[model samples]
Target: MPQFSRHSRRGRVMIAIGLSALLLGTSACTRLRTHQGYQVDKLLVDSVQPGIDNRASVEGTLGRPSFVSQFGEQDWYYVSRNMRALAFSNPKPVEQTVLRVRFDPAGNVAAVDRMGLEQVAHISPSGDKTPTLGRHRSLFDEIFGNIGAVGAAGMGGGSAGGPGGGPNGS
Candidate 1:
């Protein structure tokens, strides 16, 4: 009887330990709060006044921008954002800022604009549609329209053989 009691006590201890570990592990995954101080310096870049500051002066004051235009050297973009989320929840953008600075013909700051989330439009996402009406021919047109082997097979001459080929070999 004493041995059984000892064994039961050991089982209870193991169960308690397992439950504690499970609870701690689950609770440890709580959502983490984003640090407000975690800000990027690029947010201030687009705020730079054109004509008032040259490239060197702008760089000295605001540092390098996040990205520059590849097609033209006249535009610069300064972008920064903060993200945060709970353990299982989706990460949400805490903040986002974009700056656009344009240089003039003389390579001096010409215009500067700063936009936040409120300024951006939330339009429904659109998919690309290849213009087939009067533009170019596509595989879809060849398969479904009036081209390709399938269309050729479907085309009938009213009779078995006149000017059209065989039914299966068209």
Candidate 2:
């Protein structure tokens, strides 16, 4: 059996340690990134009194909202989240917050609300089988179903009277 020299064994150990350190360092470097959208400070939100603040004043104080209500123009939402990912994995949200401000018909701030990650909902599919309409065909049926369908309407190239010619020609 070939035996490793003392120096070679030390070098192998060093290389293994280096590779391990690299892997650990890369994993440790994975950091959570915060994506801020319409950053609404609690103090600033409190500063704006509901009845006193109008749309213009709210925009001037807190800037534009992250999203506006789809059904109406009165509700504005400020959303923020922190997401973390490792290597090729998809980023997952670690923290989230949403601030909703409602405006009255007169374009005045009517109410303010806040929602956290506690309000988040996770939905998963119930099963693997998807319900489909109509009867399912077998593999062979799918492959041969159209074999004779093409020439069913008298569109085949062969003549009626003979193999390759019409009756008058024969």
Candidate 3:
């Protein structure tokens, strides 16, 4: 039986401890980065009286919105998110908040709404096959379809051009 010396066993223990420390250190370095939108302070947001605050007051309090309504200028949105990722994986949203401010026709703040992560929707694609129009052709059909149809007439390489013909008039 091969017996390990006392020094060799101690060295092995030290190596194992070093590897464990390295793994723990690396894991500790994994941090979540918060990507926030227009930094909307809670106190300022709360102070924004709906009917009193107009576009100018809202802009001054919360700064410009993250996005305005695409259809019209009726709604403004302030969005914030926290994303986390490990190693080479894609960063995913850990938290999301969307504050919607709706304006009445008079351009005054009509309503103030807030949505949390619970409102987030995850959409999964249906399948690998994409729906395409027209009939699908087999590999054999694709390969043989253009076999002898290379240089025909108006295709620019037949015997009806000005370059060469069958011993007839130019």
Winner by lDDT: 3
- C-alpha RMSD for every candidate: 8.2, 7.0, 5.4
Candidate 3: where is the Cα deviation over 4 Å? 1-29, 138-170
* Candidate 3, 29-107: lDDT as tens digits: 6875757666657898898888999999999889899999998899999998888877557789987888999999999
Best of the candidates, TM-score: 3
lDDT of 2 by residue, 99-120 (tens): 8889999999999998988999
lDDT measured at residue 141 in model 1 versus the true structure, 0 to 100: 75
The lDDT per prediction is: 0.71, 0.82, 0.84
Backbone clashes, candidate 1: 0
Mark the 10 consecutive residues where model 1 has the least summed lDDT: 35-44
Candidate 2 residue 154 C-alpha distance from true site, Å: 14
The parts of candidate 1 lying over 4 Å away from their true place are 1-29, 33-47, 120-170
Q: What's the true lDDT of residue 148 in model 3? A: 71
Q: How well does candidate 1 match the true structure in TM-score terms?
A: 0.52
Ranking by TM-score: 3, 2, 1
